[model samples]
Target: MAKTQEFKATERIEAPQGGPGRGAMGGGMVGQKAMEFVPSGKRLAARLRPDRGKAVLVVLLGVVSVALMSVGPRILGHATDIVFNGFIGKQIPPGTPESEWPQAVQGMDVVPGQGVDFDAVAHVLMIVLAIYVGASVLGWLQGFILNTVVQNTVRTLRQDVEDKINRLPLGYFDRSPRGELLSRVTNDIDNVSTTLQQTMSQLLTSVMTVFAVLAMMFWISPLLALVALVTVPMSLLVTAQIMKRSQGQFVAQWRRTGALNAHVEESFSGHALVKVFGRQEEVEAKFAEENDELAKVSFGAQFVSGLIMPSMMFIGNLNYVLVAVIGALRVANGQLSLGEVQAFIQYSRQFTQPLTQIASMVNLLQSGVASAERVFELLDADEEPVDATGAAAPGRRGEVAFEHVSFRYDEDRPLITDLSLVARPGQTVAIVGPTGSGKTTLVNLVMRFYDIDAGRITLDGVDITAMPRAALRSQVGMVLQDTWLFAGTIRDNIAYGRPGATEDEILAAARATFVDRFVHSLPDGYDSLIDEEGSNLSAGERQLITIARAFLTDPALLILDEATSSVDTRTELLLQHAMAALRTDRTSFVIAHRLSTIRDADLILVMEEGAIVEQGTHEELLAASGAYARLYQSQFTAAAVGEEV
Candidate 1:
């Protein structure tokens, strides 16, 4: 059997301490301040290297389109001059007064009776129409190509993040909230995707239009161009100030969004618990607080970024007034033509528009980069170390031994120290311990979820450290207390571990685990659909499916970590029976809180504060009357009292 590559499913902790976008939305994260990180534009750009050729093509199309757009007003101005000269100037006498003559002929070339050239003017208009149409076509092409590139890039980015999540060490997940990691993949990557889709082509077009308009304005008249240039610095100054104030807010917005997602996820997942405890009002209040914070940050970001448009318009209008006054004076002085002044005014308006658009996109770009930074941070996380280069272990016979193992989740507070045990083939070793007594830690070490700090673990006399994780895990099967079922049919969920299992094998495993009883009664039989996390099914039902899943694999070694803790007495009895049959001929390690359930174990190890304090059969431990005996007596007495009541 090939081991599953996906990590074990577990809900993330609430309010994880740190990840990308830390201290992004407001002060700190999870009620504590976290260090902030803003990704560089150049860094985000580097991700596009693979699509450089297509990106360049899109930019080139944008430039051509803007060039065509720029020439339209100039050609139209020429046509206006032609029409004015052909008809209006025929009446201006050659000896007209110099001051009056300027007004009459300022926009006309006077060749007395160059009468209206209707054909020439119509021809120029037609060429201008053609240019506009061509530019529109180029614009559409650029947008289409860019969309393809952007979507493909985003798709690849999401895949990389998924692969990274699988490779990351379990310790990373232990410290971070699942919601926050989810935000990185879903929200953060989506932010980047939005920027690429909406802003990339627009940014390119705006930049090209600005430069193209400037060049056309200078060609029309340098004097008017100079007047228009005065507004450029003022516009830039306003944009820069607003951008500076809004940068942090944009970063904060995404952070708040992630926090809000985490809160909503946690509340919904624990909704039953909240209702049972009558904390609905409290949960709503918390949701409101997070929602309000997110709204405030988002509003600040948008409001500040929004100021660029009206501010640029004001600068544009002011520049227009100056150009009109000066161009008219120059026209009256016979130094500039009316047609040139009109074209220059159009160019100035065009210039201001692109500046405004670029200013507006600043928010999107910053938000995207912030989100990209978060995603990159996950991609750069420390992954689990590869297995040591040594000979692969022979197919495991489940002869497991831990040699002087010592470990801790945190270095300062050790959880397990110098623990040693041996489970012979076909031996069913049961572990019992009080809460936080390291019962689960023993199984975790054996599976190498977190490698031991010191000493070695072996399977069938072969060092496990040398075996690839996938290979080692393939030989072992785990059924945890929390049953995880993905969105699929019941049959598929059961056949997850052994994907190639036939219908016969699946039905046999289900029968052995007693899942067939329920499947046979359901409307869809084995084909019933399981919703996300299997919320549609009862707790016992989900556990039964997981048990059948483990059974289908027929693993050489089995680990059951409190697999029946959440069920009722009847379900527990049924599960225990199924477990007894499944454990036959296989080395098994079982951790349980109900001591009675494990009374038939070949061996029982009682743990306390990370060390084994007792080891023996149930009768043997009772005769010794030590910690195990006391624990059993207390449980037995409680059961007797409940029965009497």
Candidate 2:
């Protein structure tokens, strides 16, 4: 069996917390309801700005759509008036309507007990049909307008979300889990679109619909209308109470969902490592725990939100019975017409219909709000700005000097302190140290990846802090310890440094680095796809490709941080050749722990902790019998006596 490779213990990194202010929805249920759809004002602005022209149209259409829908009850009330007028002319009683029914319908073939006027009945029927047709057409128009509104609004929101992600700072990605971020950007945003796009429009229409129906009902009979209106607040109070209770559940649901997604992404991203470690069962248990918690929260949120519709209907139905009884008594005393009583019932139903819809929308509104807040948090994260004033492009000499530089990744933990070094033009400087020493930190200073908390760095006798970062970086080439290659053809990666380079220049760079020989050995040469991170190729091959890229750039300064540490002796020799070829006319800085690697360097600096402890030529350092001498005597003295060392 092969040995299992164990990684260094996983270290936890805490990202700063962010979101919006608390809303009026009541406590942690705000988080707990069903999601943490924390709405952010800035995120909303960003989302609206991209397709602002279309968003304006969508909001306008939504307004017009609601306005149109609000007219339905009014039209129905008009039909009721027409019915009332016919009943008045016929004088039909509730129980003795059969003989008089024909009288109401033009008095045709009057039976013994049918009291309705036949002609009157016909008139009411025609009026009802006309009202129905008019209402239907208006409803269809409202739907047409809102369909454009919803679809366009969603498209605009999604595009902005994607754009925000692309423009976000690299540091934002370092702390955030990829799956959680992905969930908010793609999955959560999709839910927000579905949840609120229609609800927002309907919330307006629901208010209007309820008012229009109430006004008509009051006109018919204020006493009965007042009775119906009482139940409305009751419905609202009930909905508000449920919404309050459900907030925490929703927040918990989103939190659990994010955790679940994080687990899935981690499991998938490290599938090979997991298989090698035989951690499948352990991973499965963790995933199941997260998923189970998510399901619970989801169910709790849904269960509470689901109560609103049915409760609303029950309250409205109870009010309906009360209105009917009271309306019949008013009619018996000749204070109400039969049509007026019928219209009252219709208005009552209309009032509750919108109430039910609005209740449903509140849940989704909170969810969208939660999601919006997270999106805005990312946009608001602080980013390093491009140096503006007193900043110029890097000059040709590339004389990099770190003067009394000190740095710490955190406020309390200093990694490099009061360290000073210089790299001259056309010279090769190598940094060596024990593991966890500040060897790599020196190279990082040259690139200005993290600015020194104290002291300053300069290039060509100019302060680097005063130089435009883009211009400074343009002249420097870097080969990182972690190799990251995009999923593109080999030629594309090589040409990434100089997009407009001629074929001859690319071939020259490849040949100089001995990359062309290996590339030509492949089936497709430079056109072959390497997939993500060059997984199809050997580690050394990927390093060679990156070396070709650096050569293509022809940067004035080059940095190789443990550049060939992973390769075998044979490949290391080829790398040495590649490095020697590239360093002939440019300044270079190499970071390695190996003692033999620094033998050809123009200058060597050995670090301990965050301080440079020794500096000199290889033979001088060996003669001094210090830290460098000890390191060399332990590892390289025997090799240098005879071989390629």
Candidate 3:
């Protein structure tokens, strides 16, 4: 089995000084925030680690860089031991051991005859300068490579999220909050990028540097090293405590941001409607409320994160003072040489370096955890249908059957019930219903937009639920009541239905739907740019363009919903003829109003309150005096009155 990544998931915490998101760890994550999303930490590290050749080169250079850092201190300590301790400008006395250290070590001797090696210090200083140059060059290369890896990985993660969204069932889009989804894709993934590229790499280098310094410090004076060690665990504990506080706040902050984003998206998408209805003030008020909530959460998170730096500074300063004072006392007591004392103090700075970094990285960790939780949540959302996994049933000619189908938007709001219908090749089946009577819902099911709560729909005698969604959808075409023309040339929009279609085919499709008339009227004809949503085109023109798209596809199954309702009588007459021609060689489903459009339909299904109450040819249904009969009667009576007027 492929191993899952194991990133820490943060949720709203309960009961603590501060925990994950909600304030402390005890509050628990709100939903799936508790799930780990990253691959194993070790695995993540391994992938990020420098490859062998690069690792060896960088480490060797890092060694030289660290050694250069050690150089300044050794020179200063020697200068102090010789000048301040009155051992300068002369060779060591004959009794002085060659270990050079003034302190005694068990079974060890320090040649402490060094007075002042000014010439030698000068030589090593040159070497240190060279090492510094080498270190800088290598650091640049290492950083460049690591950043490249991190950026690529982050890019891959973003692509993965996008691809998953695409493969997810259409129902997933209907059910999810657009704001929350956007947050996961943009904000959350960006956090992972920042942390991995910056903090994670720095942490690795800091760990090595800290250990190297401690090893050198212990060699200089084991007792003083022990004193320095005293502060290590304490500093780490303080950092950990602060991190525990800050991480939770950040998690909560991210969640709040997502909620605020959702509010903004909804408000902005509805801005025109709000203005038209004079609800702008109400919308503004709602936006402000959400913004304030985000601010409150953000402040809490950022305040805790900001505090970590100061707390670490305090701990580090205290340790620095203690190390210096104790080192001085030990030197005065003859237990530590001036040189050794100086080296111990230098090492003390190194000890706190990583502790300082740990404090700083806490914020990054918190942000990363929050993002990881969201990413994991999306990746792990349950798929819509378990059986939509196979190839589509093969047939060149179209046939669709709804077998005792039922569906509900929610348990309390059923939009379809016990619906059964069929459409065969070369037949136009018209569905007539009042609003909320499941006209669109029936079409949605045929497209497999939603699976029936209890029934099967089949194409070519095979259950559509068993087919891969993409494969099944490839054979279907639709022209919706609300025609949307994208920003493209007339030819481009028509040809979009079959991207590889020849220009002649596109022009032919446009002519078939009467879109060529409008194209010829435009300055650039078929090459003219259509403004957003085809706003440049008249409603009739846009509808024709959409019908042109559907015609271009030559789909085995076609849907035209209120296609001619928005047009003038002349345009409707044109559309009626075009549709008739389009319907001659394919199976078609149409949702019709304007009564005259469905007069010649081979079959008409009249729906009421989610059930099919009547079905037959136009005259047959009129004869039955059912729901279809009443609808025809209403139209005929209205027409009769208009005639008398």
Candidate 4:
């Protein structure tokens, strides 16, 4: 095995901690940047501006709903005063003697229950009922319209994220975990969805309700309205304090959530390795640590935010008591009526109800903003460079050359420097090296997966950099040792190479790679379903399918990187035969561990530390007794020892 960097024995890796003022729900793990990078309020508004027409319609409907609903208490007050007047008017006339009033009330049409005006009462009640019903209908309509607007916005946001993923460079994926990205795409986006669906409309309605209720309260009696106003600053003070404390916890909460997701993803993907090493307890322990951290931060955030409702309710009740006492005094002084006092009390409740809702919504909106920030960060990431002006090399013979190429994954450490090679059409060049000796990096350079810092690589004597990436990759085919097969029928997997390959073409390729051997044995034949990652098939069978896939492509050049490593001896022999046939008229670059597989190649190159150390035909290299000879001998001895066992 090649010497490569490894984790030091003394190195300790710990779960990351969030920064100061950065709460749990915010993406704020150490070395993990906060997801909410954008601070501009205008930018967020701009994102919603595209759906402004729908938003405006929703607001209009909400206005109508709240306007109709706002007068409900006042109208009910009118009905109350009407009933009071119907009874009291007949019973006692103003300025009548109190002692004589009893006889006077009786003498008038004031017989106990019969004195009340059912006709006027019913008339006013019907009007109030109609207003409430209309308000209900408008409320439902506005909610429905707002839901459409919110859902479409979420749909468009998801599409943008999807498009951004495709545009991101490979380096970005290299630096980020699959789970972290998955969290942003799923959890973070869903948070935004929830906020849009539920919180947004409620927020608008709550604000409208507060203002309308305030106006109605003042119209009823300014004295009672002044008493209600005393609670506003106090309620706001409590809400502000709780929000300040809770914000950091929320940031920390989400950051821990992301970490937990990443850990689960890593553990599950490598479950086989975990079991083989009997590290189930260790995995569970680590999971528990993250889980516990998440619980702690989530509880802290919720506990702080939870205090708002009760605190605001206390203030509301205090206002209710003050309004009732003060309004009663006013009524006794003839400054207000019993009906007006009742209406003012209801208005007080209505006013505080929205404030309570708005406080709770502020917390939810904070979380949503945090999630949106993460999504926007992904959207803002730098994308892979593409030059549409570049030429399309569509029909070129396979002639590849590398000259003084230099590259590095990091600027501080070079992986390949001044590397040069040449491979002509119809020639097979084998690259042999120990692990991490830059074999794959070299192949990556040829495929333009990474651009070189210095020097140029050419295909058919034309600079590869001048060719469009899609056009260049179309002419090359690769079959890696770690064969990847999606969940599909065997026939579908084979046809994936060309996408539009006919039945005859797929069958022919399958036969050529001996994939037909196993397909015939399965109950479904060529239609056999391969489970996810081809987990249902034997390792050798998956390799055969991958080989068949490459055969179907029939590209100008073939790259086989340890392609036979996973197959058994008999399967390897069959694949070698198939590969030999495939390479008959094609330029092939083979990277392998087994020396026997590449013995008949037109040329063999021995690589060490990113440079070609030896190059010759098999017999000539064996005669030279250099790096190639030593590698061959070591493998020969290993095979002999294996046979004896």
* Candidate with the greatest lDDT versus the true structure: 1
What is candidate 1's lDDT per residue for 438-464, written digit by digit as tens? 888888777877788998899988888
**Per-residue lDDT of candidate 2, residues 1-645 (tens digit):** 112222112111121232111111111111112213333533454554555665465455444444443444454544554545544434545455544353333322323333445565566566656656665565555556555656666677677667776555443554456667777777777776766566755775677677767777777789998999889779879988998777666655665566577668778978999999999999999888777778887888888878887898899789989998998887666576555677677778777888888887777766666556544454455556557686777798878888998987557778789888888898999888897687776776666665678999999998888887778888898887666677899888888888999899988888876678788788998898889868888887787778788889989999988877767788788778778878987899988777666689999988888888999898989899999988877776666666863
Residue-by-residue lDDT tens digits, candidate 3, 171-216: 5555445665687789888988887888755775677678878888
Candidate 4 overall lDDT versus native: 0.80
TM-score for each candidate, following the candidate numbering:
0.90, 0.81, 0.84, 0.89
Between candidates 1 and 2, the TM-score winner: 1
Deviation from native of the Cα of residue 77 in model 2, angstroms? 6.0
- For model 1, the local distance difference test gives 0.81
Best by TM-score: 1
- TM-score-better candidate, 1 vs 3: 1
Pitting candidate 2 against candidate 3, the one with the higher lDDT is: 3
List ranges where model 4 is wrong by over 4 Å: 1-31, 35-46, 93-115, 641-645
Candidate lDDT scores, in order, read 0.81, 0.70, 0.72, 0.80
Q: Provide the global lDDT of candidate 2 against the true structure.
A: 0.70
Give the poorly placed runs of model 3, Cα more than 4 Å off: 1-117, 384-392, 408-415, 484-487, 538-540, 593-596, 630-645
- Residue 630: error of model 3 in Å? 4.1
